[model samples]
Target: MPTITKSNIDYDKRNLSDKALLKLYYNMLKPRLIEEKMLILLRQGKISKWFSGIGQEAISVGVTMALKPSEYILPMHRNLGVFTTREIPLHRLFCQWQGKASGFTKGRDRSFHFGTQDYNIVGMISHLGPQLGVADGIALANLLKKNGQVTAVFTGEGGTSEGDFHEALNVASVWQLPVIFCIENNGYGLSTPTNEQYHCKHLADRGKGYGMDSFILDGNNIIETYSKVKKLAESIRKRPRPILIEFKTFRRRGHEEASGTKYVPQELMSEWEAKDPIENFRSYLFSKKILSAEIEDQYTSEIKAEIDAALDSAYAEENIIPNETIELNDVYKQFEYQDIKPNSNVKELRLIDAISEGLRQSMEKHKDLVIMGQDIAEYGGVFKITEGFVEQFGKGRVRNTPICESAIVEVGMGLSIAGMKSVVEMQFSDFVTSGFNPIVNYLAKSHYRWEQNADVVVRMPCGAGVAAGPFHSQTNEAWFTKTPGLKVVYPAFPYDAKGLLATAINDPNPVLFFEHKALYRSIRQDVPTDYFTLPFGQAALLTEGESVSIITYGAGVHWALEVLENNSDISADLIDLRTLQPLDKEAIINSVKKTGKAIILQEDSLFGGIASDISAMLMEECFEHLDAPVKRVASMETPIPFIGQLEDQYLAKGKFESALRDLLSY
Candidate 1:
């Protein structure tokens, strides 16, 4: 299709009513004036930073006005008109910009780095690409609900280079989701020009490769942009599908006020300034006798007065004070621990079966629960854990995803934001590196930043066994345990696996559920068929003795049990910590205080592992009760080898018995 430039657009055939036209003009003018006021505030040192969308107001205003208020929009930093058009409270927005407690983030974040459920807007993170996938999730939810609600996500031409951009577009196209990929070609990404960003002539052209319809618009023409986007949104609502629209615009100011636009040519700046969206649109309205100079002046005066009053109200709000208790409270929603017991019906099942049962039960209980992963549908996944899920739940609940880990993970977060729970499976635990950004940066920080709950459980099949080599077998749980707003669950036995998995699914936070690939079919226990939940931050005592306290979890628990059973003379207390993030510190301390010695064991490499934290905790809390120095047994600090003997040597089991003997002798 041909690019829709201003000269080619049919101005005389426009369909917007005069009232709507006037309202759009007011919305565009408001943000432009607000940005000018904010720039002054920045110079006067009232606000620390400002991202001026001074000349690029039409894209945000037109797109927001075109969509229904119930449809979601994920906007970028410069889209201030989106907030203003959505009618977000100016005082609260100013308070947010000024780091006040009354802000959406409670002063935890700055600028447009927050989202509000009330407005159906998901704000962008500094990493500009992930929000596209989040838009996919919201669109997917709308499709399932048959709400005919479309999701529009924004990014710049530079963001088109990100892998997430491609992945999200491809997934949306394949799934035929109702999404509008809005790309604002704003000349440059920070300092890099568009020529250096992508080889394509226009970012919208890339959409054709994904089998998606594409369009290009003269972004400065507010009437053309609004009419085109409105027609596009209407078509998408009738027949759900993804569309890419490239808004050809120019940023009048620097990426931020701090970054001066020295690289932009003077001639180019003069040309764009002459075609200013708001000014040109104002002339159009005057020519059509839809607006007068008196009314325009009145609108400007009203907008300036409104901004000043909002700033005054924001200044009256209290600033954020650093308090350990209050700061920690917002990290995650509090979950009430319930020690639910299983009924009389029981059967022997392996760890994998228990987990499958837990997921099945949760799916039956919560209709909104979805399980997405590559090869998880008819293929049953790499480990066959989801073998019969598709047959039981159908393809809607049991869905298959592309090999796009990063986008899929963010899609799960978007699902959570839309009040649906999702479980994303990483084929191998080591593959989480691809999905790490959304999990650690977006999902982990969502609740703390905007009180957004990421109720998604990521199933990680981790550990070094089965000779799967470095790419497949890895115990990377430590990566997330250090990250706040996330729960890490690693269970040793089938009983704990079922119960803990249930709790993780039910919890209103992001959870990393690690299932040892080696233990999937190895150990079996009489697990209750009835649904149950195990509390986090609670350790299970496998054995009771006084020689030493063995703190371990996952596969380490079974190894410790084997060693203790073989050497009865070396009696010890074995503690299986089911959850890692909410560490069972009280259990560890009490066990160490009773036994007077402790040994922390883990399957991960020695340095930077969870063992280091537990060792430090034992030293700090139970130093006086210790009869000997704390001991740590972990795998060698190297990549897990593929050879059977080399892999065995790289694991913790080889040194477990020897380490315990030395600690006992000490």
Candidate 2:
């Protein structure tokens, strides 16, 4: 990778035509005026909040003008200029700020928390760095499709401190993706100054460590910003590779309207104010004969008028109610991918083999499907579930990712956004905490935020019976179950595991597929040779009885079965909830109603776990039918110990049986 010195572009020798120059100015000016109006409205208490990108006009508009209209851009909060450049109507933007029904997210989100499929612009979440990796995914998809396009994702100087920034840049550089990491080095991360943030003089220098071509330029010079980005974009189109462009700039306003600038020194504010991007660019246009004083004045007035009209119209519109049903709409979509015809030829396979076969078949069916994880490629995963997959499907589809959980899921988000199905795996389900942001914020909310279908599946090897210790053995299904747009599937048996995983891959939203580590090799069952799908939110009646109804999933189903078979006098009904998110409410109610007793079981921690949710549902739905209090049997609340005997005691079968016996007797 070549390293170039940072410099300012000469306006006298600039290449952009006069017409294009005026449009660039307009793009920058529009956002500035809109932001000014937003501040005024905020003061009057019409709008609730605002993140002023007051001094960021050039960085936002310049880079936006540099890219092709077809390319994708994941914008930060300050990049309102990107939205304007991409033709997001001013009225809609105003409506969004006013929390009106016509806003980009239909008022579900505020402060640039919206994306438009039509514009190919992904809006930023409060957590900004992860979107960089999401952009890498789109770039990856473009490369795979042989499309001549590039992705430009924005960030700030302070955002560089995040682990996601490193992970995103590393992944993009490793893959040689066509992504531009455009950083606005505004000298401060909120209240903290740049000197305190890092020792490095420039943030772009970090790109060199990742083997990415990097550049730094004067952010206030719109011509320089546009010219450099245009050159980089052209190069990226020819050969896909990540590049970093750090703009030397400053934020003139406080972090937000409510955040006063008492922390900022007066000397620094005056210096930045003098070099205001909008004023500097306006003077440059007039001095260069690109525009007369009269024309500049006329354009500024017209822009303000346009903004005022938009604001007036926005205020006239009705405020959004954020109705529960509508806010929860489009959480999950019912999907049937190919017919699940039962095969006469049956084979006895372990739970792991069935899941592997299901993945293999799904890959064979969808050419655009990609499986990504740390050891999933050469090592075939820790348990050999994805073994031999690389030799069969090639490395492009079955990728070996760095040990960055967040980027892995964000890559899935990018691929899904670019119209491909992606399956990601965590080496251990317990490590999913690292990737929780992308999973919950990006993957889980993409559908609700922008109505964007993130057809991604995250495979997690979970549970504690295998004695993998605390880090390896954890049932974290409750985390995803509470998340709205995610589907949590934990199948106990081989047939259900294969069938449910198939359905998850087909589902048009993010699915957290939890495969019990203990059940993988221990459990063997007759699985159909051909493809099949078990519908989500439906529970299988493992055993029917009139005394107690045992509602459980994953390895807990096996425990319930063992109890029912051995303790014949108990006369309990066992229900296996294949999918936890779209829970089998009907099956649970009907069984509880029939037996008049309910026992919720899970391998997760007893308190605030999935069992608690099940117990709550049983109480709410089957309260009248219950003959006793809804009991729950789960692993001890403490972390799983290394000792085998202690672990057994932690999830003792006797504990579960005791709960069932109490429920039955009651």
Candidate 3:
């Protein structure tokens, strides 16, 4: 077992005043008492669950007290002292525990699963590692703004095993960001001991691997923790850099009240109990004549009364009840439609050129907009879309990120949290699977869970016509369209691509902008030279007809246009859906009602594709107007092959002709 070490630094030499020392004591004492009362409430069946931070109070209180109020913090569930020390309203915190509508997250989540921008605190999701990357983003924002703000993120020893932990640390060190990664080595991670977690002598030693400054201190010693963290924060503020500090501590209680500590040896618990941070500190204060029995009694009675009043206020509030309208309204910010039209100042450009021009205009328009991807700066990315951007925009705005997709995406979310626009390029849409967790779990749910807006645009270079194999070529729009709180935009033409991309960057929600690799250079159109934006959730009519309605997006739009061009006898109202999430269902219903026939096309495989949902919607909404059943034409349900012949056979283009003929004949 790892032994707890002590800090050799003398506390008498520290510059802290008596009042500051007393403040730290009160901060540490408050959480301990709050947690004890919460446990009693849990036993009485008042609160559903309580994660006790009884013995680990000093680490949370000390670190939080050291940071400035403007600096951001991402705290874990066990960091109640962080909240209490930050001075989050006690009544609201109690309401959050009791599931009241007035609490943070409006009672959407229990425990410390929500963040409050007012307090400069970004709470962690159950996935503890992603927050590290988020901290990097916040620090990066501060660095760019020259604010000298430091961000502190906490995690358990078990979190070190995660890929995000490594990715976040490496990125922070490489960027020399102002972030402090505090690892609370509490001896056990949900009953698994440190021996089973890793073979490292101390978790802080791993910081050397990332070229970061690291320290190991006695977490039970509150004064040492506060002094070290305060100094570290000051140093980082002066010369920004990442630091890792491992506080050797023990979890005297179980992970949660529900999980018992039976796995822990009795002797180990007894040993840690003897070194209780609060009691030890109180005794030391008494020895120094700084605290007396009467003063201690007064502090205890005042804190108890404060807790009792907060509890009474929380119980007085009404519990949260499910409301369909309110819940659905919280999913995404309301999008207003703008019919941005082209003018005389226009130039013929390929889809790629249109996108680049649009991005350039957006960068110029929004000074805070940042573009990040692998080799995007000097190398100009694999597609060369951001070529020559470094000279015009500089390396800060046009950044080359490490090949860490997951952390980069979280960083984008963090940038958004810091009130900046960010565009993250996934070199290939297929690689989005690596960064799926943060996009789906955090960014997509930020607005719904809390009032925080994730104004991030993820540029996905996708499609299968280039024969780049299964890994590089894929149409994955269906993956995000199915997820709520996200806007999925798949533009086909150059004009639509430029306009939609500009609009997505300005949108106040997470938008997955899918740009088909095949259409990037193949199609050209006269787009507006100046900035423009097209409305989302609105379908553009490429061809007007009355015989049938052909609905598609991305590469499918080109294939449907080809069918209409070849077969003049088959008159069809071709609908190109620019945005899939906020689908133009009304346009679809109206078109199908006029033509009495419908067909949905997609580049993705037929199974679980966006076509399936459109087909189902047509059936449900326009059941009486249909001449025949709605048909769906999509690529074969198989991984896209690399070879030319096999790829053509697997694509939806080959199947569209037959499906269109069947719909016409019917």
Worst 10 residues of 3 by lDDT: 1-10
Higher-ranked by lDDT: 1 or 3: 1
Alpha-carbon runs more than 4 Å astray in model 2: 1-12, 333-339
TM-score for each predicted model, relative to the true structure:
0.98, 0.96, 0.97
For this target, which candidate reaches the highest lDDT against the unseen true structure? 1
Q: 589, model 1: CA deviation in Å? A: 0.4
Give candidate 1's TM-score: 0.98
User: 2 or 3: which has the higher lDDT?
Assistant: 3
1-666: candidate 3 lDDT, tens digit per residue = 112234222345277777887888899999999998998999999999887777788899999999998999999989999999999989989998888987888878889999999999999999889999999999999999999899999999999899999999999998899999999998999999999999989899999999999999888888999999999999999999999999988988878888989999999998888788887777667666676777777788989999999999999987788899999999997766566676679999999999999999899989999999999999988988999999999998898988899999999989988999899999999999989999999999988988888989999999999999999999998889889999999999999889998899989899999999999889999988988888888999889899999999999999998888999998899999999988999999999999999999999999998889999988999999999999999999899999999999999999899889988898
Clashing pairs in 2: none
The local lDDT score (0 to 100) that residue 409 gets in candidate 3 is 94
lDDT of 1 by residue, 99-157 (tens): 99878898888999999999999999998899999999998898888999899999999
Angstrom error at residue 639, model 1 = 0.2
lDDT of 2 by residue, 1-666 (tens): 122222223364366789988888888888888888778878989889888888888888888888998999998988889998898888888888776888876766888988887888988889988888899899999988889899999999888899999999999988898999999998778888899998897888999899988999888888888888998899989988999999998888878767778888999888888777777767676666776766767878998888878878987887676578776666655455554766888999999999999999999988999999988988999888889999999998999998899988998899988999999999889999999999988888877766887899999988888777888888889998888888899889898888988888888889999999888899999999988877787889888888888888888888888877887787767888888888878888888899898888888888888888878878888889888998888888789876889899888455988777767767
Which regions of candidate 3 fall more than 4 Å away from where they truly are? 1-13, 335-342
